[model samples]
Target: MATIFTPGPALQSNSSEQNRFMEKLMAKILSFYDEQSLIDVTFKVSNPTAVVPAHRLILAAASPYFENLFRGEQGNNPVIEINDIDSDTLERLITFCYTGEAPITVNNVGAMLKAAIVLQLNDAINSCVDCIMKNINGYTLQAAYTLERETQCERLKQKLIEYEIKNFMEISRGVEFLSFDVEKLQRILESDNLNIPREEDAYDAIKRWFNYDVPARQEPLPHLIACLRLTQFDADFLLTHIQPLPGCELLAFKAISWIREPAARTKISMRFTEPRATCEETFLVICRSEMNYKLLQYNKAEDKWQEYASLEIDYTNYWPILKDENILFIGGYKNGVSCNIVRSLNIRNKTWQNLPAMNQARRGHRVVELDGKIYAIGGLEGNKVLSSVERYTPSDGWEFVSSLTVGRFDASAEILNGKLYVLGGRNINGALKLVECYNPDSNTWTSCADMTECRVSLHVRVHKGHIYVLEKYSANQSSQSVERYDPERNTWSKICCLNAEWARIENVFSFDNKLWSFGHPKHDDISSVSVYDEDNDRWVKKCSLPNVDRYTYNIVPVALLSSK
Candidate 1:
């Protein structure tokens, strides 16, 4: 009884110590369970007498600070348990939380994003997104885009937009020669608040970010002025005193207004250069309701213009070709004809002839001349989109070639450095911005850099080792937009747009060392002859085509004499 007098204080101290010990024990147990679950393993003593401490295991698992940091309210709920996630994923997630060193390939990024969202770990979520984006390719981009759309996570969406913009911006810079995916770009542009920044604004932004010296007061020089500034002057007159800059060309005073006329309707034809014995640069255009074609000739009697001749042939949904000095027109609706026929126009003899018919009648087909052979590319063969391609040699006639990865129509084809470059076209379902290059040596097509815009029925020409594409904005509409591609750099640059009335068709060619385009004018009263001077970088007007008018025009440039 006497010893018990002081027992109250002692008992109180013991009780406090026990409480603390129990608290520590619970924490250890929790950590141990967490660790065991994360790694999908169990720890047991080798001997029955040896007891493993639960607290130590728990502590190891809970040591990752990020787990607790991102736990938020979820951590406060004592009954809440972590879901079954892969051991590696859990470990990586924990590591990211602790040290902020994001795992390069954290599979199930969407799930991680969801977890980050729930945990309110903004940094972790952003890091995961960046990792996903860095690894995304064409195959993954669509999935990523879909995921972003489904999640509706504001941060994720922002990140995606940022990624797309940055990627395209970088692409735009390096794309001196590019084929754009118009639909993809349009989607991006539509989804984001992207605007066409003024040149000054772009320059300013570049200067600010790069900290490079930029001309403070860059002046807008006229095409003539710019031409005079170049150092090399050999064949300067080839550009007609117009400096053919990458993005800018000379503008003809009269041609400008003609292109600007709103009432120009959907078809107008113009003739460039009066037919002369010295420089017989003449064009005849006919714009029908459906399509148009041009007849162009280069007369060298004056030794001014090279002797070249061309005729534009129009067909309903297929690319027109010139074979045996005759226009082989494919893919168009002939009222009673069930199959598409190859309508030929003899340029040399000035007559029309029908040749061996296509096995599968198609529209919007691409015909390319490679190695003295003509290959008919993807288009609508009857009502079906076709990936099948066929080749025509003087000896073989029409024979099937390998099919493309995708079916395409309304596409443009050009030969560069002995390879076939097919740029911006559409499929049967929609418009396309895909760029494919076919190598005859390899007998295969490989994807290449894309363009900044999506356009069909664009005017494409190769000049001075560059590809120039003049694209209209819409079907049955006129556009002033132009783009140029440099195969050497594999990049595309925006060139000065043509006047609005200057429609796009297969009427573009390099004549007299200059770019000449003939198409259906947008304005009824305006002419269609568009001449681009590479030297002066300007456009000029010649006489309008006297005959043959149509909506869609085709031109075939024939060399009367070998320039070589």
Candidate 2:
């Protein structure tokens, strides 16, 4: 009994050794499958002359669909009738079962993916999905989108949608775009992400699709036309391009009504009043004094400036947001008293309309637009820093939502990835480096990684999936530094500094794929615009703006006004 085998320490399995064993085993099984040796099952495909013979044990080990089917078989060898899978797909799947690989191309990837999904072959399914996504292009987008929809692959479907939206200008010119069904075309036209320069281009695309086969496409023309922001078009386009369309008479008339009479927009559908993702934006400045508030628009193309509109009301430090063809001015001060008066300007007609008032009166507050609603964040009311927040919906009036974790004024806010981020500000204690994030879906606020330096009166802008914060420059610092926040890593990194000449930065915004800082230098009478040179990681002076006193200049957020 003492001579019985004594166990020693267990040996660790090496990955290389395991891989070699699997390779040899797979080679042997592949040979067996290729030679039709030890074949125990036959697949009868839809084609009369096509039949596949495979080893039962290998197929049973590969997929659970086959394992369950074989387990229920009443005989040693069975003939399976497959009406859904073709002969070529069946052979490829069987080869993958033995060799762990399949020759998947764009031509056959859709069919192979469908067959693999039906057979519950997870490895083959993933391989086919990868192949389909790899070869997706403007020419193949319709087919890929249809396949993803049919297979219920939600993630793949989203990728297809993004591809179509980003490449709509090219895809709409291709033959496959004409072949898309009405539902698919309608969905594409309804998206705000379409890379179109103007609403006229969208109408042109729809007309082209309709003219391809007028008789068959006429019925869906109106539906497709409704998807466009018809009101955004000018009168000349409405008469020459839209009115002449086969089935767009009603749409043309309604659009003209909204354009001529701004009040009609209240009755019009919000879909037609919304702006596309590519709306043209420009810098808007408001210089305020005792009773004078001047509104100016910057012309970047010509490096010129012009007066935009004259304001009748006197409000200081009010927040202005551009929504489609309108500009909304939220919570500010009137005669040194905090007020909740909200004003909306329809720039097309130069008309101002009164919106619902905020619940709390505050000045130096931050306002942002998300999901077609407006949010007014933390600010100072009287001598107390308030943490109250309010949201204004078009369908509903202003209502209070979740308050900030900390009450501070002069803070900067930006929307990134569907969430609102409020950065550094000043409170009773002093300047703050605290960062907080607000999620509208959960109606809650949570803290984020703090800035490297405590700051106030900073400006934040989101560009290309990153948030860039412009810290105000003072005499102590050589230049105003810019820090970028990476949401994926939840960290902040200093990218570069602004021109040392800029003694202070009043606002930071993105336009034409560049970050522009608006401010003036020390002892300078006129403000200036400096654009970030990303290639060199430094700010370059673009041009000087019209003279405005830095003490009286109200830094309005950049406005993305409708070009129409």
Candidate 1 minimal-lDDT segment of 10 residues: 227-236
lDDT of model 1, residue 157: 65
Q: Which candidate number has the best lDDT?
A: 2
Once fitted onto the true fold, the runs of candidate 1 whose alpha carbons sit more than 4 angstroms away are 1-319, 336-338, 350-353, 473-479, 499-506, 520-526, 533-537, 546-564
Candidate 2 per-residue lDDT over residues 62-129, each given as its tens digit: 99988888888543556887788889999899888888899999888888889999898989988877
The weakest ten consecutive residues by lDDT in model 2 span: 551-560
Q: After superposition on all CA atoms, what RMSD does each candidate show versus the true structure? A: 24.2, 24.4
Task: Write model 1 residue lDDT over 337-370, tens digit each, in one string.
Answer: 3245777665546667766777777766778776
Local distance difference test, each candidate: 0.52, 0.77
